[model samples]
Target: MKILITGANGQLGQEVSRLIPDASRPGRNEMDMADPGAVGRTLDEIQPDLIFNCAAMTDVDGCEKDRNSAYMINSVSPSVIAQYCIKTGARVVHFSTDYVFDGTRGMYTEEDAPDPVNYYGLSKILGDFAVIPLSNSLIIRTSGVFGEKMNFPLFVYTSLRDGKEINAIESSYSPVNAANLARASVEVERKGLSGILNIAGDRISRYEMALGIARFFGMDESLVRKGNKIPGGIARRPFDSSLDISRATKLLDWDFHSLESNISRLDVH
Candidate 1:
């Protein structure tokens, strides 16, 4: 099958690229998601039967500072891609986040309403809505995705391994392995699952997650400190953006991973 994976350099994108080695993996220069026209042209050229839209301006604080760029890349261009998928009868899997919820309560189901607390979440919500109308498109809402790139787990692992101190926040989230998330996405897409699905690992606090990383990496867990809030951040982070993956769990036949299991499977060099 002709496949296309955008945001090839990102954490989830990197994992997806590794799984689908022969897929067309494009960097921003090849198809800048911020530019809808460019994305449309590139999609036309590739004519992919399956597309993984993993591209997004994910930095919550950064998205707050630059709302225009966030909306353009996160939602507007995705709308264009969805339109193309509808026209070409292609399948698409767009990744969303747990931040779409206000975080007032935890264990959010797919049927829950989205009350985004920040611009980043609002932007992703728009992207999710854009793809919802497409019959062949699927939206996967995940949380705290981590990989070898610049992510929460990697940061914790490096800091502890280097004997550097870490003041992790107490915010709760469901940390998912990007590799495993990619695999799960493929499974659901193959199963003809459409609409929204939550695919994430066990829910845990950021500080506890840091300690787990230290233990998994054989580092001093004492080096990690618990912090209350992000230092001087523009965006307001949801205290608990944990998603309920019950649907995905059943669809995946209880193959969902937990924090400890995902850490055990880490293949860092």
Candidate 2:
């Protein structure tokens, strides 16, 4: 397939790229999704038969600080990509988040209605809507993705390595392995699955995930402290954004790893 991966340098994007080594990978400077003109020109050039749109403005508080940029990248850009794919008969794999839910509950299924609590989630929810009707498209909602690219778990590992204390949030989530999610995405695409599907690791809290990272790396788990609130945070987090992957589990006949197994699988720098 003539494949294109947006945000190819990001955490999930890099993992996706590693799995699909020959896919076209444009840097942010090359195809900034925030700019419609750039996205248009890039799409025209690539004319990909498949698109893995891993790009997004993911910083929750940053999304709250700049709604325009958030909506542009998270919503408008995906709309543009979907429109392009619609005309060209290309299939797309759109990455989404568990943040679409309000977190009043846990293990949310695809049937669950999204009631986002923050601007970032709101923007991503809008993005999901834009791609919902696109034929042959797959929207995979994942959570707390960490990989070779710097992410939450890496932060904990480094903090403990430096002998600095870390405040691990108490929010519960399925901290997905980006490598696992990426590999599974390819299988899901090959299986011709459409619409929304959940792909994530076993559910656990930030504190628990922090300790798992420490255990994997043989670091001091005691350095990780638990807290419910982010100090001076801009956006409100969901209490439990863990996704229920029952559908994906049956479809792929593959379930993600447990926290311990997942961390063990990672090189986890």
Candidate 3:
């Protein structure tokens, strides 16, 4: 099957590329998502049966500062891709975030209404709406993504390597990894599951997650400082952004692991 993946250099995109059976990944240099004409032309050339989009403007603070740029990347680009999928009858698999919901509830379901709190969330929510009309579109809303080349663990590693104190929010929740998320997306797409699905790690606090990561790296857990989103600076993060994965598990016959388990599975070389 011919497949096209955007954001070929990102963590999830790279994982997807690794899994694809002789895949074709066109970087931004070949096909800039920001340019609608380039995206359309590339899609027309590839004529792929499946289009997996892992690209987005995910920096929450940056989104808050430039809402227009966020919308252009998160919404406009995906909308253009969805239009191509509709025209070409290609199955589109798109990745979204738990930020789409306001985190007012404990566990968000697929049926829950999205009331995004931040500009990044709002922009992704817009993309979710943009592709819903396509019957072949699969929307996977995940959270707390961490993996190779990702901002989360990479930033933490940098802090630790620099011997600087690392402050992570202990109150927020989410247990997702980009590698596992990419694998899950491939399974769902292979099975032709179309609709909104919450794909995330088992719900857990950031404090416990830190301990797990510290254990994995054999580092001192004391180096990890705990902080709260409210008292701390930046946007208000969802205190309980855990997503209910019952639908994804039952329908896809898939099981997602915890952040610790995902880390354990990684080869440390």
Highest-scoring model, TM-score: 1
Name the runs in model 1 displaced over 4 angstroms. Answer: none
Clashing pairs in 2: none
Q: Candidate 2 — worst ten consecutive residues by lDDT sum?
A: 260-269
Q: Summarize candidate 3's per-residue lDDT along 48-98 as a digit string, tens digits.
A: 888889888877888888888888888888888899988878888998888
Residue-level lDDT of model 2, residues 1-269, one tens digit each, is 79999998888898899889999999888899899788878998989999999999999999999999999999999998998989899998999999999998989999899999999999999999989999789999999888776777777877888999999887889887788889888899889899999988888988888888887788888898887675677899899999898887777765564786567656544
* lDDT for each candidate structure: 0.88, 0.88, 0.79
Model 3 segments more than 4 A misplaced: 154-165, 230-234, 251-255, 265-269
- What's the distance in Å from true for residue 218, model 3? 3.9
Cα displacement (angstroms), candidate 2, residue 73, comes to 0.6
Candidate 3 worst ten-residue window by lDDT: 260-269
TM-score, every prediction: 0.94, 0.93, 0.89
Residue 174 CA displacement from its true place in model 1, Å: 0.4
User: What TM-score number comes out for model 1?
Assistant: 0.94
- In angstroms, give how far residue 205 of model 3 lies from its true place: 1.6
Candidate 1: lDDT over CA atoms? 0.88
TM-score of 2: 0.93
